[model samples]
Target chain A: MVHLSGIKAQNLTEKGVKTRMKILETAEQLIGEKGYYETSIAEITVKANIAQGTFYIYFSSKKAVFDELVYQLSSDFRYHIKIAMEKEDTFEAKQRAGFLAFFEWVTKHRNLYSIVQQAVVVDEKLYRAYYQKIAAGFITSIGKAMEAGECKSLNVETVAYCFMGVGQFIGMRWVVWRDQLVPNDVFEEAMEILFNGLTHKGGKKNWRISRTGYTNEQ
Target chain B: MVHLSGIKAQNLTEKGVKTRMKILETAEQLIGEKGYYETSIAEITVKANIAQGTFYIYFSSKKAVFDELVYQLSSDFRYHIKIAMEKEDTFEAKQRAGFLAFFEWVTKHRNLYSIVQQAVVVDEKLYRAYYQKIAAGFITSIGKAMEAGECKSLNVETVAYCFMGVGQFIGMRWVVWRDQLVPNDVFEEAMEILFNGLTHKGGKKNWRISRTGYTNEQ
Candidate 1:
């Protein structure tokens, strides 16, 4: 058994990167289905059709691949957002578009999203990496909107963090935890509540982007 | 030991519900320091200076005590909020006072808050019970406010759930995750933003009281 395992490890190393990708993809799907703690290295290797010993050659531990997966997933999310933004012109559209797209993506891939969440509680390394990737794109765009005078200029970083926190909080509350979302119109209502706020009286005499990207009061 | 445990369980049940409260209190303080997972029945017994058998008399499992502790803590939270409102007459003052008292209480004893957060990720029983306690007082207040026309006629339950999620998320992000927070003013700023929101012109808005006890918004 040991000799066969050794040969399998060498074959995996010879196969190179695809072996690693296969392991990661297998881990992602497995963790998504059975959770991180429940799924073992042996399970991942068997599912990936690699030898048990071959798993450690590509990644250090269960946690490392989880971190890499989150990083890659976040990158994909940001790429999608960038592509979506490029497809639209105005800043307002981008803001609304960003949230709508995020909500849809998260809902459609609920399993993956839950895996990221489960990773957070299971390990500390995954938690930090998770938070970093969790809302970085949304945070960056909020800063850009401030610079472009599309949104109010306050502490851009704080607003970004606040929005990310609130958005996820609402998503977790509605979709993940309770599932009482108002069908298709939830995001529209959310965006309306978020952008216009509960108090905004449409577009007149309310706060808007300035040429200087900041209000005169400051 | 089994005989002693059985006798103790019988004695505890034979007496009244007061023993349960004592066990929960010690569990709360210990679990706060040791955390939910790290905490055990032995630790609680040691802290309470009770026998290991006595610990099992009131609680079934370590998780059971943790869940019950959360329920009791939120009950105390609501009771405190009720008391704070009694001291303050204005709707604005009452709301701010309620949140202020809440922040102070939660920040002072973040261990319990951390445990509740752990429940969000770990245990299902603790999760639902935690949110239920959270929803109760918040929903009641929102319902009262709406009936009095102090705010929009929105779903109080949804708003309550959202507020609970948002408040806990920020508290976890700022207090638990960050090792340090500068200037107490940030919390005040946070509360202001939460209530009045960023859309409102900057600068602190002091909470004001209405002439009547009910409300005046629609």
Candidate 2:
């Protein structure tokens, strides 16, 4: 519901913050690789090379770590997207940069889709909040684009989800499933669909043109 | 990956088939509600009012039932979409009907997203194949649409995934997350974006039209 208030902002000594971050990074990798149910506090400590008791100083429980990880990942995701978009000059370009940044970030994290999706079963509220937060980012940026007349007047919520869907699935298909970068042509083609749609500029009236490029009578 | 060879087609008496179906339906609900790792075979049989050993007769293990459920859900999904699309007369209409049918089906099988997504962690291969099978269906349908000039010439695979993503995130946003049907207006707006894109039809040349709707100097 709120902008992902990631883990209670813990005030800690520099060393303490580093150790906490180490624990979080280790948990992210382990949970992403092995799953939340399978990963335990003991394992996270072991993997982080810290004592089991040390984990409690940071996170209260394994579920707490998972929640914090989701929040952290969500925060990191939006931050990266915002940074990428800021470098672009146009709304369309910003979107392209955002998509590119998303693919890049997910490629590095690799466990993002798996870990975040697990929230659906692991914690329903967290699952919803995670996406709602991300969609909020989309809604704001998109609403501005519409107001600036950079886009159409279609419902912004609908547009936001559609935008999110395009990014999510394309990243899932190439970056996650295939373990490959989204090739330039593939990315461009998808952009074309987003910008111009499946209807060719010339064949605007027909939704079904023939194999030989003829618009058959409907 | 091979086509989803959904649960080995077993020859059984009519009563046996019905009992098997009952187990599957029960498993779908249980897994969707409680998640795969938490739900046990004993719990499943108990909930279904069957002997624990009887579940083994229908499925070799908990994983087997999960796999079969994924297969069954995918098969049922495609069948329904095919039927709904067939009833429509044009490619666009067929896509609209297909999306509508998909929303309706997922609404009924509310666990479809959760169960299928869990496949990522439960069985990565099954998870990938489930989506691949669905994407294959999209590719074939969208390919035909493109060939017939019903749609544009964007890369079919990219187009297929884009199509898949839109349906997925939109469904997740309204149906899965909100626990409600996708509103008619929202659905229509999404359709408009798909066919016409985020760019206004008349303002196609403007990437940054002013608040006054003027396609101003860049």
By TM-score, who's the top model here?
2
Candidate 1 chain A has its poorest 10 consecutive residues by lDDT at: A207-216
The sequence of per-residue lDDT tens digits that candidate 2 reaches over residues A1-218 is 11234345447766777778888888888888788888888889988999988889988999998888898888887888898788767778788777877887787788889999888999989998998888899889889998999888778889888988989899998998778768777887777678766665443444331121111122
Top candidate, metric DockQ:
2
> Pick by lDDT: which candidate is best?
2
TM-score of chain A of each: 0.70, 0.87
lDDT of 1 at A31: 71
> Cα lDDT for residue B139, model 2?
90
For model 2, how does the per-residue alpha-carbon lDDT over B123-202 read when each residue is reduced to its tens digit?
A: 88998898888899889888998889878877889988888899999999889877777787888777777877767554
User: Model 2: which residue pairs collide?
Assistant: A198-B152, A207-B150, A208-B149, A208-B150, A209-B148, A209-B149, A209-B150, A210-B148
DockQ of each: 0.11, 0.39
Deviating ranges (above 4 Å) for candidate 1: A1-39, A43-50, A111-129, A132-139, A178-185, A199-218, B1-50, B85-93, B178-218
